[model samples]
Target: MIAPTLHTERLTLRPLALSDFEPLAEFYASDRSQYVGGPKAADQAWRTLACEIGHWTLRGYGRFGVDETSTGKFVGMVGPWFPDAWPEPELGWDLMNGFEGRGFATEAGLATREYAYKTLGWKTAISLVADGNTGSAKVAERMGATWESKLNHHIFGDVNIYRHLNSEAV
Candidate 1:
């Protein structure tokens, strides 16, 4: 599947690549990843990135690797995803270490949400932010989402699902 490229004022979202592995591995190895099922070994991180790419091939839509347009630095992954056990398609985002505090996640997330609604023809979208992840919760809120419910998955534990109130707002 050909992944479409998306852009914001400061970032560009594109297909995942081999170059994304190192930083992704670093993120997964750190405690910051706990909310997103991280603290993984290098190999696990590799497989995880691979799975992200394959998600596009199989599902025709998946997370995009985002980079800072000005510096061309990788920031993180953000886009639409619906993994095996997920209840439904969702808009998700994960930022690299130094990228947090910059609102990059929210920017990319809003773009993905718009893509899911306008480009993918989705009527509604939700962001499955992990419980206790205040940072992500803030991003969701900034994107105009409101917590609507919670979900408990065998792997992800408890996560709060924030529903997008206006799909056309984007």
Candidate 2:
């Protein structure tokens, strides 16, 4: 199923669209993408975006392209992610430059986690933060996630996994 649009207090989380390519590609090309494996070429960025979109078809749940509600400006991507070989379904996010330090990632992440449990019937989820990605760690902490363990990811080596409580069960 296509990802349905989600609204938050200050953001709109919608399905990733073709129009998001330019900015997202630029984001991928920048050093700011270090935590998410960036500084790549435009072609690589395109493939990454394609993979995010393709994930929905494969798993019925995937990332949402987040935008500022009032301005309709793309802010970032946030949502459920569970690739093959992943230790668990994860709630992941990437906030573009100039948008960090705000609460966008936390707000969007909370919304996505709610959807993960309520809509997808997930009992638990993890946030995979690359070691030393303190920004993401802070967001996860703000979202009520607790550091669970560490694992060496195939793609992102030496990752910190934070576990979130199932809101429904709380």
Q: Best by lDDT, which number?
A: 2
Q: lDDT tens string, model 1, 35-90? A: 99988999999999999999998999999999999999999999999889888888
lDDT of each: 0.90, 0.92
For model 2, give the 10-residue run with minimal summed lDDT. Answer: 161-170
What lDDT, from 0 to 1, does candidate 2 have? 0.92
Where model 2 places Cα greater than 4 Å from the true spot, the runs are none
Stretches of model 1 off by over 4 angstroms after superposition? 168-170
Q: Each candidate's TM vs. the true structure?
A: 0.96, 0.97
Spell out the clash pairs found in candidate 2.
none
